[model samples]
Target chain A: MQFQPADVVARASFRLPAADSAEAAVRTCRPLQDELRPLAVEARAAGPDEPGEGFTVEFLLKLPAPQSDDVEGVLRTAAAPLLARLGLDAGKLDVDVEDRDAIVWAGDEALSKGGTACGAYVVHLRIGRDPDEPHELLPEGSLTDEEARALTETLNSLFEQRPVEEH
Target chain B: MSTPAWWDELMSVSDALAAADRAEVAYWRGGAEDGREDSHEDDVPPVTLRLAALGREFASHAHELTAEQQHRFLGVLEDVLRTGSEADGTAVATGFFESLLNAWNGGFDLQAAWAGVGAESQACCLDLNQFWGIESPEWMLPRVA
Candidate 1:
């Protein structure tokens, strides 16, 4: 699958342990953003909270699509080294891969069915905490039954649209 | 003072891996004593079962493994793969490895699987580049076309 620069968005969130200070966490993550700069249309790091205790560093990346079919490989290749550098514990890091096209398709399908037109669909296809729940299409609150049906149909169609490869 | 369920599951996986290791050793030793290459017909089933159990246990409780424990688990898995390679061949070893990998990956939450076995443990368990036959860092390069 190919992606237009706008079509794919990659986010990596590094949730540091309570023992780690925000400055230290940002120090660890800054270089990662630098390293990722060449690969992403935009790469950024968001922080250890100013007043709060939690420390989280995030990278928001945009890349052209027909992106690799190996989305997992792409995300791992980018975040693994950075995570190792931080010496973060298991379950502390999260990476999200979103297909904007799929999100738009679902949203438009929902709108077509009489749902309120939200500005943009923030489809969180993957989240760190609830990794097992497949296809979390968001703008999360409540969906009209017709809107939900349309969204589901849109998702199913998107799945069917993937290119079949010979084993 | 009670152990967490995840820890219990990890212990079960460790036990299963140890049992599989012993079975493999015995299978090889028996073949050597008989001065014959073992067909491994009898050995495969039990070992497979144990590996499957290990995979299931890991899938359910991978997040529970301490960093040290994760390293130890990876080391044991490497040993299994190495032994399988030496005894049977790369094909057999690779097949065994892939099966276990699939089961382990399948057992996890989808996001975890997609995120992969965390950065620290990834190199020890499987090299994504080598596994996918993509060059390192270069694969991350965006395509202009």
Candidate 2:
């Protein structure tokens, strides 16, 4: 991850970490590289997203084939196995899938509390890697600097923080 | 104003779908609490397919809907987002909102259709990308609080 300036705004398409639990997720939930499987899916860090050796994980929503009932239930079910397989919990890390081609971001801990999980096609949280990337995380040009910092700080901390477990 | 027949059918199906969604969420919640790893996949999962069916039906007549009807269509979904469970919100967004939003993109005045709803619903429209990557127009984007 590149060094982030305070003014850098992140325009992500997935649910960001809740302002409250972001620090906790970063510190407690983030697993070491060995903990997670090798990121085999193609990286979606396009259009100014530089992966910088960081990885992107594809959250595939495994639903009961052909049954379209309780999507949230299905996502919840799919997320636990997937997240558990990755050693992530719903609080610090839970899975929620959007519609077709959408994968609930493993980085999204905000709605993991009580809300249903939501996702993107592929999650590449290039939050602050590049400075000029105008964000759409919020509305066009509507994110106050304070909101931007609060959001990016959590995401930046996701990669920058050390994994104490590995040590 | 009196509602259109097709709109009524859509609303009826949506209500049924919402109830099924709640039941399904509860069922999964129960299963999770029981500590079972997909013990019930044997039963047919119908929500995803049902939504696709609704989409096809909605699309067939979606272009004919008036802006007022659009308001009503979105209003029901908006209410679900507001009053339903978190699971319900996700369900409506994924199932109904995604379907209707796609139909709107094909050709309906979403802004005009969204006119009757409150700022909250309008904001919901703007946040489609947050759900499954439904990109909203620059004009439809709301000012974040």
- Compared with the true structure, what per-residue lDDT tens digits does model 1 show for residues B22-60? 454344335542334644433222222234345545555
DockQ for model 1 equals: 0.01
List chain A TM-scores, every candidate, in order. 0.30, 0.27
Assess each prediction's global lDDT (C-alpha) against the native: 0.38, 0.39
lDDT of 2 by residue, A44-111 (tens): 21123422211222221212222335544444443444444433343442222222111333343433
Report the C-alpha lDDT of model 1 over A1-167, residue by residue, as the tens digit: 12243244443444433423223343444445445542211111123321223344333344333445565555444444433443332233334445322111123343233221311112222222222124555755699999999999998998876678899
Worst 10 residues of 1 chain B by lDDT: B1-10
lDDT of 2 by residue, B27-67 (tens): 53355423356544333222322333354445555456565
Off by over 4 Å in 1: A1-167, B1-49, B80-84, B88-96, B104-145
Retained native contacts per candidate, as fractions?
0.00, 0.00
Residue A151 C-alpha lDDT in model 2: 78
